[model samples]
Target chain A: MKRFATKLLTAVLLAMFLFVGTQGFAQTINIALANNPISQALNKLAKEKYKAAGVTVNIAVLPENDLRQKLTTEASTGGTSYDMFFIGPYEAASWAKNGWLENLEPYFKAMPAAKLTAYDRPDLIQGMVGSLAVKGQSYALPFYGESSFIMYNKELFAAKGLTMPAEPTWDQIYDLAKKINDPAKGIVGMTMRGAPGWGMSGAPFVTIVNAFGGKFYDMKWNATVDTPEQRAAWAMYKKVLRDAGQPDILSYTYNECIALMQSGKAGIYYDATSIAPALEGAGSKVQGKVGYAMAPHQKMMTNTSWLWNWAMGINPKSSDAKKKATFDFMVWATSKEYAKMSVDLDPTGSSTPPAARTSTYALPAYSKTPYAAMTVKALKAMDFTKPTIDPVPYVGLQYIAIPEFADAGTQMTQFLADYVVDKITLDEAIKKTNDVFNQVAVDGGYRK
Target chain B: MKKKNDWPFILPAIFVVAVMTQVPFLLTVVYSTLRWNLARPDMPIVFSGIDNYLFFLKIPDFTVVPEFYSIVLQTIIVTVVALVICTVIGFLFSILLDHPIPGVNIARTLIMGPFFVMSTVTGVIWKTTILNTTFGWYGVLAKSIGLAPVDLLSYYPLPVIIFLFCWQWIPFFVLIILAGLQGISGELVDSMRIDGLNWWQSTFRVKLPLIMNHIRVAVMLGLVFIVKEFGLILVTTAGGPGTRSYTLPYQVYMQIFSASNVGRAGALATMTVVLTLLAVNFVSKSMKKNNL
Candidate 1:
């Protein structure tokens, strides 16, 4: 009996070893991404497309903040858990400078002509490409690009006998909001991000400040947060939000604003154009009732729309084989063919994810979508070279490009929130914000 | 000779403790002394002894904001308030559970449920479902009754966080105090009543004194946990409405991740450790003096 048991155990151990060895031969690439509709579609397509090529794709979709924390920790330690990571333009330059991202220029240059031409390098949006570049070298590929815009309920406008122009000023928006606001009917005049984060409320607020002729800094890196333009912008924003916005404006983020618009509770929603599909998709209460317009401007010196993109970058610490697999997957994921496939898979006009490729925008199926023309126009109208009316050191529309800008912007957002909620006066908020920005610039050696 | 033989049995635990506790702490101290800013990699790291510490401690003459001092005060207030509330409420619940009543076992389990729920979930449920101005029960109920819905978290972020911490920790105190109550001899309670003491007097004079040690242990544990609270603030308010709810841990997190200043973060972390150690020491010394 002992001999028989020993033989059986040996057979089981050998079987397990063979099973594990066979599993190792199949290539698998892991991706870390934020939880969003575009990522969800890409994860599904990656599995279906890569399975036949003897490759497996695994995706870990996490909340926005959680994904940021995970990626930051991984980059700091040079961990190899994720071969590819989704990064926003705000962190791309910093990540590249820190040697956390693999430069993709070499891979793009080495690609075969057939694949290169098929990919159509010139078709990618210029601003999107520029945002993902470091020192003229591309470090990431744009999966989808977006800029902010205003989505208003046409039915509400008609009912209230209000007319919304194709290009409205900030004053016009405020006037419309006041006219249409009806708390007793559960209709909010406007929905905007008020959550306290650099990327949340700060993004829209910066755009507003720019339209008000305010610049974050002068060429000498002297903080201009205390300028008259900025103070006027803050005052206007607070008045509009207090008199026309929903209650608890301080707690409302993009998600809350989206919910408010989709449920027909909001008359105007100013946020990323990426929310267009979700708002117009099936089962939405306000589907087919929404009208689009450019982001509101004040002085018309600079457009108020903010440019942002969700892009993918290869991990610098990943093994060569994993990097190759990751690049291959990324190329296919962001290609025009994949964009068509995404639309085909869903077939709903609403499933068409915003494409970065010019060719994809020209597709008949995509153009027929409700907000496609407006989105493409906004994308073209984005001016990254001159994000503000006055000359400044930063290149971003919604944020300053330097890494220290995150902390500075977050601090300013807090003071802005205090001003909005009546916790502090406008002068106090402006002084505190200027102090924080000046301190950051000095500490970073950006100013004498 | 026996002691020499016992070294093998104790060496593994000592090694684990050193690796788990001492090594990281030593690394934090070392890192705190360097000029390490991840954002400015062009600048090389150098020895910068005590500069990071002074950066946090220094008060600017131009402004009276007292940023660091405010965070420290907020941390102390939250910890003390949460400790007092949890201990008092927990003691009351423990007395009620000590009696032999029908369905008491299930009732105890129900009361202890919040302790088992994760802190992140607690923050989310409270922020989104309970306290949110729109789509939340508070909002819906307020609107239904013709009243303006109040955003509790926006107006009272720190107090709401304190309530959440107390809610989560009261169960812990209840469980520990209940165990202490069970260990006490029932004859003492009967003897107190036989001496013409009322129920309330008996609880204060006898049961309270008997369970004072358990309460102290609970308070000490609560203080340690409260001082390290990050997820509750991170998920709910994110130390916001202009840093009104910024705690020490959240401040350290902002320094490292948001600011990308590793040296400053390390300095803040070391300070936090020292503060926690001092608090623990004070509490333990007081407990010894009281002989509870």
Candidate 2:
């Protein structure tokens, strides 16, 4: 009995020592990334680098919804499901405010030379880096940034004798959609994301609302859903979706719209500019025939372009070692050298995510690509300093920077979807959506 | 020895059930009473005394009364519709495949295929492959057949979702009822046939009543499963069409995850648990009455 007890104790101590030793010697970083082409490439690149450094990176590649759910679950629970994660500006700001993420400012400050080389540079597009701040805190680092744009089939335009302007308006896009639509040939005039998610649909909706001079909240953070500008925007958006867009558009997300465009089924696609590379890839039937332009406008281009990207955010709950390792990988992965390496590795150019660094655009290799000028122009035009026309008590390029925004935006998307499906008339949908916004405001103590 | 044998038959199952369900359920109830944000620095759980509940209730746009009621009503409508449709279709198909048909096995396999598909994948397939307005095969076929494109999701959302749910669920009903059909004593069926009643009469009077227990189990289980369904609603419509199809579980998700109001979310969850219990009691009571 004494011998058995002694043996058991020895085994337990051995196991504990093994765990600590392994944890100390080899830093294992868990990265939760969204399942996009860019993310896939990033994962592949990350594994190679981390493995070479004797670090094991457990990559949880999940669909966008699943990734968000898992990340949110882990974040909310204060669990260490991941050491590093991919987040966007909206999530970074709102989540950082909630203390859901580790502020990277301190780490960046600690490694000034590396940070300067990677993030702070004239060569790195100032807009991209500038967009990563929330309440004057650098919460995340941009891996890639994008503004929404209109990608049209130049062949279809030529065939239909339709002319696309240099900077097209919503009205012009509508007309073009009508002219080029040929359902008989399985071609639709346009495809836009109408799916019910803040990221999927709300991005475009914000742009539309902005173009119509519809501020979600007035300068005082008062509800503006019932405003005529918003109503007009909703009505116009509904009309365009009904007439020129694909059927069951409310089901379409970024990937679905991209598929529609790549398959030559869509004459126009209004979505994130990051899709330009995918659309220009060899697998795309419309590869060489696609043209890109800025997102359509109705009034002024207030927030016509949405600034969105997959970004690295450090987990607040991570151990110091884990945090350091995550920051190391993030800095390296987002570095100019990494971007060049990615481009070199990606012979197809589709795998390399468009990095936010201006040096990436300046690279002779990137400049010579099919999407070079248009993508860079769109990325450069991603102005985070001014997203909404009217001043509001928030900071987000394409989203309202509040914790309640996700819920409110989702509900708002559902209302917009209702308009698309013709379940409710434009007037009714607007009223209902306004009611939702007002209710949210009241509950949030933003209004009486 | 007999008493010793009794626990062996039940102990493992009880243990499994306790671990898998009862504990988590208790945890959820506890979680319902507190303000818990997963990502806080300290992970401090605050007791809000139903403040979250009141807050969720007071959100003018998403107040509990109209929205929750609408969601509940929609769920009931869809569940009932799916139940009737799946039962009828399943019954008919079961009868069709009972004996020998050239492609009966293949048809059976195909029917079961949708059941095996993950809910998210099924939603994706239905949304993109069939109901997609632009490149969906249905749209392509509609155009090919000289019909103007049908916006299935836009024009027919609830029915489309209900149809997809029913379509997926029918195979279970068919398979279970088929098992019940096969289990019936041949002598009893033969004796019934000897009485000179036609096939329909035999089925309606004897066979169906004999399988009433099976139907009760299948339909009630179906209802429970259907009512608790979150993935389909989450993936497909997300309880939209202006919350026309919003169900209880989807509402809970929207409240907690979307709204970030843990208190309100807990209240909604507690209410749903109460409602579900009430429903289960009503179903079981009605089932008992029918059995008696």
Candidate 3:
């Protein structure tokens, strides 16, 4: 028994020694990122450079919903499983307020003078910076920023004898869609995301609701989804999709819209402006045949577009050493050097991250791209602080700015989808959704 | 007497099982009694008694039923419908394939292909390649016939999902039932034929009784698995068209991951387990009664 006890003690001590020895040799950080085109490119571009920095990176690329769930679980549990993660404005602001994210402002101030100069913290887009900040404390670094816009096939418009206005109204766009729709030729007049999720159909749909002067809530947290203005927005959304949208409109997401535009099957596409590069670059059948326009409006004219970004944030639960290593990697990944590397790596210029930095737009190569100016213009034209014409309890252009909004808003989209598909009456959809949302608000102690 | 000393050998497994299942379950029951919303970091997590359970149980209006009941009903309907179709069609297919024919093994293997495919893959194939109104074969075929194809995934999501579940699971039923059919003695078959028993009588009266045990086992396994299916629903309908096809497990997932209400999720999970156990017990009892 004494021999066995000694042997077990020695084995445990040896295991501890090996663990400490390996951890001391080099720092390793785990980063959770959403699986998107730009992040895929980043994963490929940062391979050798991350290893060369004397730190190993373990990245988990998951679908957008899965990424959000995993990162939220880790942070809420105060687990140190992830050292860094990719987050959007919704998560950045909420997590920072929860005291879950490492304040990157202090990290920025602590950088060596010369290194800070090279990092050019000021050159990062202020709009993105402000969105990811809470009470003037920065929570994340913008990797890429985007706003919404309209991308139309100029050839289709010309053939139909219709010219798109630079800033069109929703009514005008609907009329044009009616004119341009040609199902016989397998062409639809417009394409938008219709998949049921908060980020899927809800993004574009919320902006439409904003343009139509509808708010999800009143100043005192009363649900206003069944209001006249909101009903009008829903009617318009349903009318266009039913008349001129894809045959499988309910199944279409942004990827499908992109593919439809590239195939020249869509007359108009309204989605993220960042996808313009993909529509105009090599391998696109509609290259040079697409035209850009601002997001459409009906009542509220200004700030009709959305502001969105996927930023990098540090986990507050990480040890100081891992946090430092993670901050360094975040710096490198968002640096000008990485931007140039990405641009050079992608010949088509479609997959390179963009709109995060002022200097990126100043690059001679990027400015020459036809859609770069429009992308920047759209990004600056929206404000998330004031989303609707009427006073509301939330702040977000394309989403509601509460942690509970992701759940409630997604539940609301199911009713919208059913309404869009004529599965339920408009009144029934409205009553069910409002009930669900109001119940969530009351349960979460958000409403009085 | 040396056998009494064997506890040391069994204690590790008991410990592992306790840690893996019972401990977590106990924690879940404790959590279900609290008011914990992970999303609302501002709210204090405190003991709230049975408030979480009551939240799901309370229905404000009979006309407007709560989602929990609807989800449970949908789960039952989907499981029961899918099992019936799979068993009926699978038994017929097994009877046909049980005949002596060349390349019978090939046919059986081909039928088993979908059962081997991942559920997510099956959903993707059905959604994108078959049911998609614009990009799929259904669209082309419908258009060729001069008729517009309605979006089956959105309009008739429940039926489409039930059909796909049957397509994928029927093969598993066939495998087991066919084994039972092949096990019947050749003397019995010769005796049935000599007694002028028709094919229908032999099949429905004799063969089915012999295979009730196999069918019961298949239904039990199917119920256990299909009730917990998440990926297929996610990849295809996503529990949408106003949660018309949502199951209890899907609701638990939404409560935990989407709502970030750990307490509520625990409540939903406990109810789901209870409902599942009740279903399994009822099935086992009914099957035993039928056997008797």
Candidate whose DockQ is highest? 1
lDDT tens string, model 3, B17-43?
Answer: 999999998899999998999988898
lDDT score, candidate 2, position A373: 80
Interface Cα RMSD of candidate 3: 1.3
**Which one wins on lDDT?**
3
Per prediction, the TM-score for chain B is 0.95, 0.85, 0.95
Which segments of model 3 are wrong by more than 4 Å?
A1-28, A48-51, A319-321, B1-13, B194-196
Worst 10 residues of 2 chain B by lDDT: B56-65
Stretches of candidate 1 exceeding 4 Å from the true structure: A1-9, A47-54, B1-12, B286-292
The better candidate by TM-score, 1 or 3, is 1
- lDDT per residue for candidate 2 within B1-292, as digits (tens), equals 3565566778889999999988877776776778764433344677867666665455455433456666777877887798889888888777776766688788878878878988888987887777665657887787777887776666676898898898789888988888788788889978987898898998888888888777777887888888887788777776766688778788888776666556667678887887888877887798788772
Please rank every candidate by lDDT, starting with the best: 3, 1, 2
Q: Estimate each model's TM-score.
A: 0.95, 0.86, 0.93
Residue-level lDDT of model 3, residues A15-103, one tens digit each, is 99998988787877998777666787778777755554558888878777778878888888898889997899999988998999999
TM-score of 1: 0.95
- Tens digits of per-residue lDDT for model 1, A144-197: 889988999999999989989898889989999999899889889998989877
